[model samples]
Target: MYISYKPLWHTLIERNMRKEDLRLAAGLTTNMIANMGKGKHISMETLTKICETLNCDISDVIELERE
Candidate 1:
């Protein structure tokens, strides 16, 4: 299975927030944000922070792709 963060990007767009805004609001590092941009797996803790900051759920930010 593959993971994608496309949903998160869309969500951010819907909220009129930029990637840097998410980073600051969620207290995330540049590396972490970069990782998400590359569709890399991040820690559940990080996921929780993002979800909390965005007022969203894990499902809202990420999806799995079956291969």
Candidate 2:
């Protein structure tokens, strides 16, 4: 199975937040945001910070899918 982040992309748009904005709000570095854009694996701690900053659940940011 493969995880996809299109839903999270949509959510970000709906929230009217740009990638850079998210990075700033989440206190993440540009490199971290870049990695997320590439769908690279991230630490749970980082994910938690993102969720808290965005007031969202993990499911609202990421998904698991069948390859």
Candidate 3:
């Protein structure tokens, strides 16, 4: 299985937010954002921060996929 952050990107676009904006708003580091861009897995704590910052749920950020 693989994890995808497609929904998160869509959400950001819908909110008119840039990656930098999300980093600042969610207190995430540049590395974290970069890793996500590369389809890397992040910690649940980080995910929670993103969800809270965006007023969204975990489902709005990531999804599991069969490879």
Per-residue accuracy of model 1 over 1-67 as CA lDDT, tens digit each:
9999989999999999999999999999999999999888999999999999999988889999886
For residue 56, model 2's alpha carbon misses the true position, in angstroms, by: 0.8
lDDT string, candidate 2, 1-67, tens digits:
8666777788899999998888898899998887878988778898898889989999998898887
Q: Weakest 10 consecutive residues, lDDT, candidate 2?
A: 1-10
How displaced is residue 52 in candidate 2, in Å?
Answer: 0.2
Instruction: Evaluate residue 61 in candidate 3 and report its C-alpha lDDT on the 0 to 100 scale.
Output: 97
lDDT value for candidate 1? 0.94
Report how far off residue 25 is in candidate 2 (Å).
0.6
C-alpha lDDT of residue 39 in model 3: 99
Error of 3 at 51 (Å): 0.3
Can you list the residue pairs that collide in candidate 2? none
Give per-candidate clash totals.
0, 0, 0
lDDT of 3 by residue, 1-67 (tens): 9999999999999999999999999999999999999999999999999999999999989999899
Candidate 3 lowest-lDDT run of ten: 57-66
